[model samples]
Target: MSSDSTKPEEYLSKINEVRTLLGPLPEKSSEFCSDAAIARYLAARNGHVKKATKMLKETLKWRTQYKPEEIRWEEIAREAETGKIYRANYTDKYGRTVLVMRPSSQNTKSYKGQIRFLVYCMENAILNLSDSQEQMVWLIDFHGFNMSHISVKVSRETAHVLQEHYPERLGAAILYNPPKIFEPFYKMVKPFLEPKTCNKVKFVYSDDNLSKKVLEDLFDMEQLEVEFGGKNSDAGFSFEKYAERMREDDLKFFGNTTVTSASALLTNSDSEVSDSENKHLEDKEDEKIKNGTLESSLDTLEKPKPEA
Candidate 1:
């Protein structure tokens, strides 16, 4: 963690260092290069300016070539048909977005497709984060899960993509009701998880009162699904409904970015603008997302699994 003094001037100075090191950033790189975004990368590297610069530069290259943000839901809709992964309709007690994943619901054989869908979900989750919240929670339901349902390669690749590109974006992940057979598989992938990432993962079982309390504390039982020991008992995921919500969010994201880009250009034109002034303006943009002006459809995103 950076010291308290690493704000305003010092923080913006580091951000500028990263920008200078990377030279000219790629197109559509504003959000990725924002003060908040750069600060996260720096923190992920424990405030090492050069290291953070390298990491952010690699991500910028990836974003330019891989185009993770540009991945449309329609391209990965088939991978989602089984409800393998989707943004949760609710946030945790801390107001962090939730992404619910079910391994047993795996319906695709293409590893590339699986990774693409995961990236899509990650990008969408970020788009939905509340202004003050920079992370998300992952609830992995293990009911009916078995060794056969596991894919070690995909697991490692998933860990790589997440830790490398989406630094500091995971607040916590709860592995609910994992069976004994899943232990070895977890052990295999454990090495792939950075200590920071591994610390956020917890194993909880319905039969264990203490572990079960983890969920109780993190979620409003009324909003959490019954499958996770919460009160909500609505019908599980509807692909058609979920797709509609994602498409709407995609439209909103593009629309909002256009206006934001324009605003950023106007603000950035003043060569003498102070760091505090730039931060103030960017904060206002973030507040709009939190206030639902350019918000994600996460509030109504579907959950659970037709496949599970």
Candidate 2:
């Protein structure tokens, strides 16, 4: 593989240091313990080996606890059906995966469910990555999203998960056509994000982002939907179709096992974790978000399956 300018020779040293800190990962976690994986932690820590090692161990423990990769599409189907969040078929000019979210389609009743849904999308995005790309960009379509959709706890937890467990994976996050009311909620969520991560967020007014640099220069118009200035905007994308594709991919990934196991939550007895621990989940908490009633909104949402 060609050298990544963001990762330098010292990255290997940092990786080794963190590896020494965490000890050997399980055979299945080979991907999680690679040189490049450790390099990402180093970058997240600004090359400080000790800090990087600490962060690495914490994230690895979280990974063992969370097992985000193992979450089945079945558990997230209801949220995905809303089409509020999804992995777009196209990549940006730099090959980073593109994720689209419609804040108005917040139909799920549970906060952990929503976070898990987004995590499912993010994990699927990584699974769909080409060898060259390691990051992603989020495009939050704020159209029709009123104040009711904002939740401080959900926002804080989402940002925490991204900054903590999934460090160094966000290439950029662009909020498109945010209404004026979004500012207050956005401000509340800003403090939770890392300074490095906060810098990657961009707010674009429709009038401004309609310019060539966004749709034309940063992305190939033909690869995207026309709503986002791509050719496929008119081509209706269905949750059923996308989920079917994901299921097929999963079949190949799991060697025909349709249902996968849910990740076991953290306990004191886990091998790597038992050595010591800084923190653990207190309890499964739900954020109280008052999303507006879905009246005419169903017209825009995808029905994952006919309710019984």
Candidate 3:
């Protein structure tokens, strides 16, 4: 016998090990019976058949061996053409195995649609992508929750037929003035003002009403004015200019440029008048006391002369 040839006893031992781990593989469900299941089955048999703790742990370890770092999008396209299925392992942010399925497709539409759909489906569930070639595959076997349970198989022919009826929506377009960019600015400043006051908050770039709504919900009106310009002028103020203005003055007292200046002038004038009036009143009081003392001294001198 060749040195590499396995003895009958060794072969039997390996088979027994497999049988020991998994209760006999279910005869009816080949699709559902996975390697992890076999490991769990054996672990369960070794202990009380009712308790699955050991089996579950061993199965988890087996599943973790193939965890991948990142998912690739390109390989998923190729697998779709061959009509062969591919599976890969991926890990999520929480460190769970993410098993991904790669569906085979013959056409571009079939492949792209599947890829896009899979990405959308896994957005909330999976942590990272593992591989991408003919078909995009991810590893998601963590905690024995099969992501494929929710997946719907898209055949190539069906994909082609659907692609004809419904043209795919293009990827979101980049805008010079996207509503999202202005949303934060609006939101940060809208709450400080009433609805009537907010109407004055002009939308410079886009007409999207959603942008306006976002601004209304998140921003204080006073803060929003600073974003537009320190003062409403013909030339809009840059952010740096606005910052400089804020640094130079107290923002709380400086709501409107015209009103703030006017208030400061009025306050100074009122303070000066108050000080002058106080001085005049003090001088009059001093004069009255001097007159009273003089009258008392004259009265005392007259009384002494009369006695002499």
Best by lDDT: 1
The TM-score of predicted model 3 comes to: 0.15
Q: What is candidate 3's lDDT per residue for 1-308, written digit by digit as tens?
A: 00111222433443345556555444433322334333223222332332333333343443233111112322133323332222122222323322222221223323234443343233212223322211111211112222221111222222222221111111111111323433443353344222322432333333466644433343333333222221223223233443343223322332332322221232323534644644454344334333433232222211110100
Query: Stretches of candidate 1 above 4 Å error?
Result: 1-12, 255-308
- lDDT per model vs. reference: 0.72, 0.66, 0.29
The TM-score between candidate 1 and the true structure equals 0.78
Residues 70-128, candidate 1: write the lDDT tens digits.
Answer: 67766677788978899888899999889999999998556566787899899999899
Off by over 4 Å in 3: 1-37, 41-77, 80-90, 97-308
Indicate whether candidate 2 or candidate 3 has the larger TM-score. Answer: 2
Once model 2 is optimally superposed onto the true structure by TM-score, how far is the C-alpha of residue 191 displaced, in angstroms? 2.6
Task: Report how far off residue 78 is in candidate 3 (Å).
Answer: 1.7
lDDT for model 1? 0.72
Using all chains and alpha carbons, the TM-scores for the candidates as numbered come to 0.78, 0.79, 0.15
Answer with 1 or 2, whichever has the higher TM-score.
2
**Each prediction's Cα RMSD?**
16.3, 10.8, 38.4
